[model samples]
Target: MQRFLPLIIVLVLVGVFLRMMTLEGRNPNEIKSVLIGKPVPEFTLPGLLEEEADLTNAYFNREEPVLVNFFASWCVPCRAEHENLMKLAQEHGVTIVGVAYKDRHADALEFLDELGNPFSRTALDRNGRLAIDFGVTGVPETFVVDADGIITYRHWGPVVGDGLEKAILPALEEAR
Candidate 1:
């Protein structure tokens, strides 16, 4: 029994060490940056326009830069960032595209109508595959893609006040 006691202790210690190591290296908010200096992921989603516009083809191929915002009608932070996006879209000539993350089409349309449709094109990501491809762990994430479809900047959480001009715009300008 005495000899076996040390073996059990060693096994338990090994298990604890492995668990601790896993936790130490784990980052809950970690998102991979795939769009940085790379072509935007190809996605052709249905738009909110009357003509059912294609977002990836129409916007990515354009000569001007574009902003892509991932949001959901159920996300509260998205509401907080709505005004800032609206102002940015109106003031700057930056093209703004919205992806409704894992939401019903009707709810997304209603949310836009109530909050003000600031997006040039709004796409419904009902299955959340696009959001996952973009490495989005939460809503209200924004990405700035240059004219060449290269992702220039990414912002997580609610963007407010000078965040648009201060952080996002500078990156867009640099990419330009």
Candidate 2:
């Protein structure tokens, strides 16, 4: 057994190396979300537009499907997805809600002012607790929720390039 131990270790290392090589060519954002097909986590947070106003999960209870986007002012990729979000909100008549994850209120407001606010209701998730409930691995994640408040699709990274037109738009149309 002692003589074979070296062989066993070499084989284990080879297996690990091969597995990593498989992921090397894959995009990290292609990681599937665990929250897909589950009901959205419930929470009540302060509205981003007004400190006193409430932004709750109840906002998703509507006739139309809502896109709940989790972003941070500090995230550069979040800026990349802004125009696509605006198109969905204004041109497509979709309800886009933002959860300001782990960002200062002033910074978030400044981000909106500079980038153009597309969200109908932006929820302030100051402590990132709400993001945890949604199983967020990082900022700039977006979830598509049906009118029944069930999460149908979760895009793991900033929706840009073909992401918005391919993944997000199709999922939203199906949800609607």
Candidate 3:
């Protein structure tokens, strides 16, 4: 019985993991962020565009909520969510700050040129330092920061499908 104890534990652990994965309405990509309900981390980043100014935490301390999106030109899911981000900025008047995660300035510029720039201010996270501070798991994660600069919500993965209408928009409203 003692020799079989390890095997039983492993099997039980595997079963629990599988059950969690199969849970109804559980989004595999949605990794709960530790920064939610906390103040955003302080950091400064260079502008992705030549004429744009540097982006900092101070920009998020405004009267309205802001969306900070982490994306990379090489990420396919980032491309998929670009249109929805544009709609949020243009049609809904949402303020979005973009962070180009571990991407070259030129490539990021080309990406924005091809797919219209929706961000009010774009920052370059060439070393992924900012992403780490924000507890970002990957490119295409977005955080909704409230007026007082507290992160109210985090959406992991591309904001596609009904994500904007159902998740992102409601988060922004609640933050307001």
What is the TM-score of each predicted model, taking all chains together? Answer: 0.78, 0.84, 0.88
Q: Over 4 Å off in model 2, which ranges? A: 1-30
User: Candidate 3's error at 100, in angstroms?
Assistant: 0.5
Steric clash count of candidate 3: 0
Question: Can you tell me which runs of candidate 3 are displaced by over 4 Å?
Answer: 1-25
Tens-digit per-residue lDDT, 111-173, candidate 3: 999999999999999999999999998889999999999999999899999999999999999
| Candidate 3 weakest ten by summed lDDT | 25-34
In Å, residue 15's CA in model 1 sits off its true spot by 25
| Each model's lDDT | 0.82, 0.89, 0.94
Give the winner by lDDT: 3
Summed backbone clashes in each candidate are 0, 0, 0
Candidate 2: C-alpha lDDT? 0.89
Give the TM-score (vs. native) of candidate 1.
0.78
> How does candidate 2 fare on TM-score?
0.84
